[model samples]
Target: MTTNQRRAARFNKAFGNRLAGPLLSRMPGFGAVLHKGRRSGRVYRTPVKIFRTAGGFTMSLPYGPKSDWVRNVQAAGGCQLVSLGRRFDLVEPRVYHDREQRVIPRPLRPLLARFKAFDFIELRLAPAGAGRAER
Candidate 1:
């Protein structure tokens, strides 16, 4: 990440996120990624723009695929997604770069592209009674 990017990330971590997380977590087309720290074993919830795909969901890695939360999800092999105010367990995370940005809805493609976001992660919904639980 460049200096500006790193500073922006730090700013979000320290301030912006605290204000946006609660609202974003409940909004349609937006969600929260609930992942655990790979080493610290601490839990985190990050606001994200998520889109549904057949049998799964896709999230753009604007922070880049190497972001701590993304790494945590990959290392753990799964994570929980809070979408539309409901919690869903997800597994089989697949992170890859796609300039076509095909899995997500078309309208969002341009927006992500503008951010230079070509990397994304897709995860299948955990089977009912396998891991998913909603409230």
Candidate 2:
């Protein structure tokens, strides 16, 4: 990889593990985790901001579909969610489209705008069972 790409990768890895993971765990409605691809089997942990919807918990991937975590979620159809020192299994993910992006709350628009450069994808995570550990 190019120097810049290498730098970004390094930064993402460290930030996800050391910073994002912990912070998301403390949030009221957040359910972030480290997920792996079932096919490629590559591992990556992403800090996802989740919103509760009528269907379930929808997590927007600001970085878009090209991101490793997004791709992994697609491949695995499921993932292990780590939060508040607990791990829970997530169900299959369904990708949402641009038109549907508008459904995202207005308050998060600025944060979502940061992904304008990428192909955005949203995944709804369903908790496998009741009383799943928080972190």
TM-score, every prediction: 0.92, 0.64
- Model 1 per-residue lDDT tens digits across residues 77-119: 9999998878989999999999998886788788888878888
Backbone clashes in model 1, listed as residue pairs: none
| RMSD, candidate 1, Å | 1.4
Provide the lDDT at 84 for model 2. 55
Best by TM-score: 1
Residue 30's C-alpha lDDT in candidate 2? 70
lDDT of 2 by residue, 1-135 (tens): 346655665687676556767777667657665677666666766776666566445676554455677667777676766655666656667775564366578776666665542234444445545324343
Judging by lDDT against the true structure, name the best candidate.
1
- Candidate 2 minimal-lDDT segment of 10 residues: 116-125
lDDT, each prediction = 0.87, 0.61
- CA shift of 10, model 1, Å: 2.1
Q: Give the residue spans of candidate 1 off by over 4 A.
A: none
